[model samples]
Target: MSYVPYSVYQPLTKNEVTLLRKKQFEKWEHYFLNPIQIGQKHTEFTEVRDVILQSWNRSKEYQDLNPMIEGSVKNISDEELKEIRKKNEVFHLAEPVLKQAGQELSDENHVLLFCDSDGIIIDNYGNHSVSRNIGNSVNANNGAQWSERWAGTNAIGTSIILKQPIQIFSSEHFSYNCHEWVCSSAPILDPLTNELLGVINLSTTANSFHYLSMMKTIGLVNQIERILFHNYYQVREMMQNIYIEAISKWKNQIVILCNSKGKILKINNDTQINEITSLMSVTVENNECTTKKEWEDEVTLHGSQYRAIHKKIFWYDRFIGFISILEKKSRLSHSTTIHNHFAKYSFQSLIGNSEEFKRTIHLAQVAASSDSNVLITGDSGTGKELVANAIHQASNRFDHPFIALNCAAIPKDLLPSELFGYVAGAFTGANPKGSIGKFELANKGTLFLDELGDMPLELQVQLLRVIQEQEIIRIGDKIRTPIDVRVIAATNKNLVEEIQMGKFRKDLYYRLNVIQIELPSLRRRSEDIPLLAEYFVQKLSVKKHHGPHHITAEAMGILKNYSWPGNIRELENVVEYAVNFSANGIITPESLPMHFHNQQTLPINSVSINPVKQAELDWIIQALKRSQMNVTDAAKELKMSRSTLYRKLKKMGYDMKSLK
Candidate 1:
């Protein structure tokens, strides 16, 4: 009786204990009923919690001097209540979180409840027969509003009155009916509106009462608020980022827009830029301007000062955010936008330190610095387009458009028109005005022609001419327009073989193959298997509803030994599938796809390794083992440089550095 609920395990002092006993007697006597003495009784019980005491007072008034109350009112019906549940999203949104929280508590019989703002228990999870404890006769369905005037001095009703979290332990219930139960309840308020929406609760038998239950319930309510906040902003943030990216190229000044909620909606760039941070504003805007205004004074950024502008952006005649443009505010924009036209991937995204991969990246880097036509060759799923994206982003043309066209994906006849724009009346389906071809669209950018080997011979001649002449002519219009585009072509088939077979033009192949980058198969870089698998797991985990995931060591070993015929793309898909099926936060062989169980065996002849290749593998394996399988350290141990070691690894199919 002397203990304050959820007080972090502190013992009450002698004076507090003495005070509690006197208050408890007065409160009990008041609830026990003596109408004329009730007011005097409540005034003397100074130790009682204001919320709890107030709730009891309201309950007594509602009971109309009745000393005992047995049940809750069932005003809402099964059907009508079901409709209410459908109307409320909090009931559904809190279900998964409730389930997780209920499971986290060690007590199997603990129950979690979600109630509407009116205190109607809408959803209950955890421990079977959760409603039976409160008596099944009370329409123990989505029924019963625990208002102070209804259910009296209990967790839910008192919490509603206090507008804060509270706990009611055994024998504390004003209703003689629920005295056997102990419950913790926290009010869930709308973060945006700050209005009471509902209450989340944890309940169990008297003996199972937990002091931290109130804390846990409060934590869950906070979490639900955060999830709601993020859910509303996720799409808005993505849109803001897209807009920022589009304006980054043109806006060399500072422009920021924040929402009504004071959250950063979007900005041209990050915080005050590096160069702009050094300068103090010469003149600050003191007068509040309700409308758009031109900056009369300037602020210095990077040793230069420029004018600033202020504008308010509104939607539907309501203020949403601000758009402030600062000129000569040295530094960069806060947009944090990845320009759509720019490459989506780069060397940083390649994700492999294997020698073969490094050499390929090196070649791609060298080719990126030039304006030459580059050819990237690899089997399907070997990340050909990845290399192209990397080169495009690193090249001087990175800020410009990076248009990709799949020669094989497009219809053969349409390929010509698609590559070289068609004019009005050029063909039946051609646009009336005119169409700009990929060549024109990528005039100052890079044109990624995927599956170039699959291009028809006739079209190849025109493509070859475009590359040679730096110009293109529309099908209907005979006017030749000059183009200055960088071409990066990718092929899965052997171009040389296609030329010999007369399916591909030899001259076009030569023209497109100015600098070649050949990607290695996954099987050839077997040591990179674990690395890729872990990366895929972490990347794919974000898409899961559960927490972070991990793969068992045995599962990883099995993955590394298997031949990945479909290459890196296939590896990603396999990881995704395994993650989807994994259980208990860990992926085991049992969680893997059936194909993993049926790993194919290599033929005896193909399994044979030459002495040099064997030696290379042994040394690399030893070095990797010594460096804890780190490529950077292993390269240094072998007196090899980063890209140089990668090239060496590719030279002999795959080379291993020596640990010694």
Candidate 2:
């Protein structure tokens, strides 16, 4: 009587039962044929003579079926052996993601197979019955040689080979054994380039497989792609936003907006009235006057006291808005000095000229000149690392390596291994050889630790010891390594405050603060506006391989009066923006960004309101009209404190007496 393979189980699909039966038959055929080959080899070749001759009686059926095979058996050539090894190589790639997914698949009566590009099983998980039936280990340690050609064309190998998703079921499999298994596979793509990253598959015995399993795997792959896509986008966007905010926070008085239409849409704290009016006038011109849309130069309507520049903003596929640059009338001379100072540090490659920045760079250079540990404090996007790099390059150590690392970029658990070398076999799956940390790599050079505030306190202590002793002991080693290295640490957060909160070590703070450089926010420095614009315009033109470019005098003026919250980085960005958007030969107030336009709506078209100066004018005019041009009495009623009121009237360029 036929013996049951193992035990009774539930009924299975026709494909599933057929696959098991076919594989069983192939196994029986192999067993029955093996003894005959052994008998022939023993008769001619001496390698397995004793065992082969002993088993010859069991192979009578094989001898009757063949004639030439009865003489001798031949050895496989090196080339033939090489082909077997090559097939094994393809299965190794799927070992990791498969191992991680093993437990989950085993419980579900499912086997996850990592196949080579050829659909040969490289690895798998599940019970012996399933594993054997699936035929995963026949070729390698995985013991399976099932290929789409032998099993059937399927999602696992087909998707990876084609670099696209595919599905194949029992009937679709090329081989009867694979017909019992159903598979769903998708191409894992690199988030950035949309290239095939790898292939992911979910499979089960035909009896256990369901359509839902296929759907679930596809959903998982999609989620991974979405996550990768979002992360890439956020990284870029965060950098830009941080730059803008850093400048804006410091330059509180200037409001810079990038809006549609090459119009100045807003202004910051500027005292000049006539200049504000002219800028407002330009905004009106951009909106109402079509007039061929040619860019206009710096226009002096009321006076030559103020200047403005216009630049357009473009992102992705469309032109988003314009950036209106505004600046003050006074401080032009000192502004020129600041501008030149900025030029010295300013990159024809970078844009930004601000007083605060000039001082910050000067301090950074000084810090760099010495080996003293420096603490660079500033808001995000204020170019803390840029400043650090500048210091490194300016110092005597410029010839040596200047390595910068973000202390907070790595996870806390891995920070130790990342910062200090780890001995070989320190942990499972670790490099067989020791791995050197960044600190060791930066030996005899400058190590710029960015985002130092984010380092965990535990790692901080270890780092502090390294800095103090000028040595490090690798994980899993007793030997101490002494090295000479200079450290430059920068952070956007206030470490002093962090210290008070018990988050940072005071000792480490002192070590890092040996020389401290606090960068000023962009808004504080109003004097360096013009040179910055010119620098950005020229730099961007060169980078774009475009115009011999210019930002008109008016544009320069607008830049000065406006607040810059994003600092030098923002200034550089705006310049790059203007340079990039320039279709005309020059960057005019109209070509400028709309956010730079310091204009607003009014009830009447004729009523030109310079908000900063207009408020004062309105007050003065009302006081004069009420007092019948009596200055002494009008000052009292207006509560102007006399001299102050007189000064205000003079500044407003209005005579109450004339109104009377």
Candidate 3:
């Protein structure tokens, strides 16, 4: 089954649906309460899951009334404990996946529980603060035996027994102590064999039932299984490749070849290779091939037993024929052959001379010089991403990958796998061989996390942890892979305001804001408009294969004076539009978008761009209002003495007091 993302679960789940469900829960509760008076025969609760009914029956059979919060467990010998742990080694793969998921539901007063195949909790945590409040009823701490017999029909125990995913809420939990909590659980299984391994359970307060709880738990279970499957496939592929390479190297010496099924597919140089019909036949017809020197075997065919060495592989845990290693041997390995992604922009490419713009670029360069996390903030089209690319290109990590992902573009459920990656069989619908995540791809380089304010708070916690530890655990994999990635996060939204609104995490904000670079909006740096537009025009000419073009003074005035709400990005689009509309290499007012001439929101219904004259003229008018015609106070407000303000205005041919 596919996962139900929060978008569908949280919003579409209405108050009416919850109220309807509460009514149904009351029906099941009534039936369970009147067990002695009610007959089991022909008695059924409509809309109630059979599994839940079975759990209730099991609890009734055991005469377990008012079951305690914590279940009793028999002490095992060290050897037994070790064997149990070893058998449950696969359970560790679910730790990170569950940890991230638990934190996702932390605000909902939830906790995550992981149990071995026997339903004994090996690990448990979530919102520890909420967990503490639930007291003994909730805290199913490590080593708690929660099998159906011990825990008495709980989600974890019931899941293990049923070998399927299940959800139990409040009074539905067969035990009285667990009535305050809602638990949704999915069984973890062997990726290759689908054998029941354990269960991944999410426990939350019944009063605070989250709509996505069951869906998320099931999704996580699928993810963990996919990881196991992925890892197993990788191992088989790796061994097959190694075996094929070894045999090919000794092809001339032993003149032998075999296919994946151990049958002699081909042979060379009249060597008696066909005598070994199959790997197992070789082992059977000859002496038992032990003391396993890889690819070496004693085989007998045609009644002649000879010591033959050919690559042999394994399937499951059984030794089998050599699997095909079809890939050609290459001089370049993954590390060297892997493509190094390039950043499109460098500091020199940031075309702006405005003081505010220049200061931002300089700060970006400084941020690049040091390997600190950077937060680039500005309006959507104000070149925050370009600044990020420039910083990456300028940094020591330039030679490595410059991975970029827009947080807003990816779905919330898929973000975890895309960021950290997963092992094969980590979940259903996952690749059989697994896939690499951005964190791994950006190792030793820079990862540009754009639209970071849009990142869900659940993921922010994990992101903060990765930043602090400089490490990540793949989904359904226990190994902690270290990464040296410089994070450059960009956002159009104000992160400080987001943190105040509780949409962003304070700790993560501080971590990512180590080197903050706030780019100026295009409106704030109006003088740079011409320079930026000209650059875009020139750049677009070559791309569009249009002739070199010059914008007329009238068109430039419109471009400069009209306030650019969409910033540099919008300006670039406008330039492209103008180039296509322009003819004879000259762009006039006719080439500008219709809105410029529409004058609906134009400042003063006229378009004029004169940097020095316009600035002095505006100041003369503004200073007059602030000073009420007093030149001295106006000069002070301008941070200049009275004579300097008057002289500066007069140099540009402005009569300051008379104009005021």
Per-residue error for 445 in candidate 3, Å, reads: 0.4
lDDT by residue (tens digit), candidate 3, 285-383: 443355342444444445544455443443322343442222212322333446546676788789988887888888988998999999999888998
lDDT tens readout by residue for model 1, 1-660: 222353324444546544544445456566555554334444545656555565566777774424356645545777878888876756655667877876775346577778888888887767766656654532224567776667767788777877788877554567665655668888988777788989987887655555566677889999887866764454354335434533553455566554433344555667664443222111222323344322344555555666655343332223344344566543443434443466777787788878877887888899989989999998899999989988999999988889999999999989988999998889887788978788888888999999998898898998999999999998888788998999999999998889889999988988989999989777666678888888777555322212346799999988776656688898899888888888745789998999789854321223357888777756665555434446786676567787776675555454333322
State which candidate, 1 or 2, has the greater TM-score. 1
Q: lDDT tens digits, residues 495-585, model 2? A: 9899999999999999889999887555444456686667556445333323346677887766665556577777787777666666545
Give the number of the best model, judged by TM-score: 1
Score residue 249 of candidate 3 by CA lDDT: 45
Clash counts for all predictions: 10, 58, 15
Order of all candidates by TM-score, from best down to worst? Answer: 1, 3, 2
Winner on lDDT between 1 and 3 is 3
- Candidate 2 minimal-lDDT segment of 10 residues: 338-347
Q: What TM-score would you give candidate 3 relative to the actual structure?
A: 0.43
Quote the lDDT for 185 in model 1: 89
The TM-score values for the models, in the order shown, are 0.56, 0.39, 0.43
Model 3 lDDT-worst window of ten: 323-332
Q: After TM-score superposition, what is the CA distance of residue 622 in candidate 3 from its true location, in Å?
A: 11
